[model samples]
Target: MWENLDRPPLDGRALTRALVDGPRGSWSRVDVVARTGSTNADLLAVADTAADRTALIADVQDAGRGRHSRSFTAPARSQVIVSALVKLPGVPPGSVGWLPLLTGVAVVDVLRTVAEVDAVLKWPNDVLVRGDESSGYAGGKVAGILVEVASTHPVVTAVSGVGINVSLTEAELPVPTATSLQLAGAAVIDRGTVVRAFLRAMGSALDEWRESGWDTAPIAELYRSRCDTLGRRVRVTMPGDTELVGVATDIDEHGRVVIVPESGDTSPVAVSAGDVTHLRALDA
Candidate 1:
């Protein structure tokens, strides 16, 4: 861990004090570990009995995952990997779908405020920076969010995991389309600061979402405004290999992306789940 001079280890003690003891204390508990297979999976294991706002962060994730069970990993201390358990006793089932979107917005907010990365949302779960043509970066993905339903009987408990690349170099990226704060020229790259800001931002957003009766209108609007996918020609790949090419028009009340098919014969469709690929930008 000391070998990577540029990548400093997170101050777990400071984090626990600020996030758990500070006036703006939003998390009930925060646990930091040196290594974990997956924070989300580990948190889910205790979600049934853990406190409502418990949080878990790992310095290095050996088997981190994203949407659709895609696996990824980063060098030690090169990313902020965290998972939080949020228990919503009365949240509507449909409203639960927006959890991942809410998480994406929180990540973008933290990256912009703390990292100063000029980040934006890529629909359902990705946070990205506008690629620089000169740098040959085709809008790399800097962070990913994954939300899983931990329980639904007694209460709607959700375990949301987020992974933000902090100081990964070009060669360290898991994929060609992936990027890090260092690669994106962020002003700050402290994992602890990023994690703190993200937790606070997430707590605030979740509070608003709950106060709004899981209305989703306000959250949807906020997400749409920051979403780069809304005004673009996109190709969506749904389950079972179904495909739809269209222009993203809006985010509906249920938090689905409304896609207006390029074909004149088909009507607009609101997709709840799929992989969206941005083909080109379009005027909203």
Candidate 2:
């Protein structure tokens, strides 16, 4: 798989040491694999694993997936793909709504500060950035996050799967709406740096979430501030192929998107799951 001998694979030992050595070290372990079907599936079934903060990094994700089980595949060694497992023993099931949103915040923060790119969250968990102006692309989806939850008798755990486009060039983009860190003029494309920064940010965000008992107000407010979907004319293609065009007004307390139709007096409709597109972005 890794053809580039010069590019180091994710250094699990170094990552674990860095994650566990600091005073704020919240991670219990880091594991790296040469290839895997899906880290989220692997972590969900890791019964022998201890209950703590654990991350699994892979060189090749042959069967990665996104929110709707959409295939998410990138060439080996071209991106930072990782899944972080977090166990929260006492958190109520309702609080789980905050997991994906908080994880998005973490990814956005790392992209902006460490990678020196203006990253924004697209509603649930897609990360978007503006590419170079010369490329004729204003903004493209650069990363994605998926959150899954597994429960044991005594505890509940969440797996946050993240994919960050690191060193891919324009020609290597998986889709026309997607771009990579290198193409976006990121200051660094070190996969290890990106992973470490993401873990640190996730740890901090999880702490804030737990402290607030998964309060939706503060988290929702923060997510709204960084979210690029709000105030945009959007199209939501629902599960049954039904479509609705409206302005994305807000995110309800249930983490559902509020869509106010463009030409109708219909009351706001909150959708739980759908494929969203920025109509204005497409026209731009």
Candidate 3:
């Protein structure tokens, strides 16, 4: 699904080639583009015609997107941008919404294994490393995941994109709280190794998801176990001018954040989409 342009292509070919040669349980076709506006956009452009297990990767995205349409920034040749296309079988239509969460679990698995760092999930789909005294929660955002789904007839193509900060220094971090493997004291990690580990992890997670449907309990537990947001005072901004301030309780079976509101309401509210802000801690 790549249209080779006249310009020199980006160097994602090495990674694409490696995955093609690596162990893939269900993945069949892998495509690597040098530069794209967004890997998600590229996958969507050809989603209707592409086969299952087709992976689209780019070296850098000029207009990468994250949850809530936030722009994802990756320096040229310093990060990993990979999107895998999968065809779901026998999964209910409504349950497809949790694919991103499942993919997040896989991302965490790969990061912990490949980088050998303590990576945590920050709700929804952000991977965070704990910050030390000097860094102070500038804990690196080692990786992030985004999934897009399209259905036609008997097959649903889920385009899963994962971005990892492999070699960026502290100065290269996109945000104050962001971090990279190098800055997190990880030795020089090979991007290709990280890519393969992630693909294998994703393949395993997808297999489990297809077999069990969207039972998000295991996925939620895995996420919560590595989550840094749990048990913290935070604000969740919902759509259309609604918000909730509460103690982050737990993630429910359907991948929703269970929150205990400030009004002392014991009933749990499931938050499907929102911006979360962790309250600052006061010194003792």
lDDT of 1 by residue, 1-284 (tens): 47777877778889989999999888999999988999999999998889998999998999998889999988999999999999987898878988999899899988888888779999889999888889776658999999999989889999999999888988899889888998888888888888999999999998988888877888888899899998889999999989889989999998889999987656889998999998854622
Residue 10: error of model 3 in Å? 8.4
| Model 1 worst lDDT window (10 residues) | 275-284
Please give me the total number of clashing residue pairs in predicted model 1.
0
Q: lDDT: which is higher, 1 or 2?
A: 1
After aligning candidate 2 to the native by TM-score, how far in Å is the CA of 112 from where it should be?
0.4
Off by over 4 Å in 1: 133-138, 281-284
- Residue 90, model 1: lDDT of 86
- Model 2: C-alpha RMSD to truth? 2.2
* lDDT at 242, model 2: 91
Compose the digit string of candidate 3's lDDT tens values, residues 1-284.
Answer: 33423212334555555555554445666666667898887887888887777787776788998876789776676787888878887766766777887787787777777787778777777787777786554575677878777664577677877888877777777887777887787643676677767877787787776666646567666777877778987788889868788888888777788888876665778898887777765411
RMSD of each: 2.2, 2.2, 4.5
**lDDT (Cα, 0-100) at 283 in candidate 2:** 49
Predicted structure with the largest TM-score when compared to the true one: 1
The candidate, 2 or 3, that scores higher on TM-score is 2
Tens-place lDDT per residue, model 2, 66-158, is 988899787787889899889876777777877898889889989999999989989878999955578665669989999988764477777
lDDT of each: 0.89, 0.85, 0.74
- The model with the greatest lDDT is 1
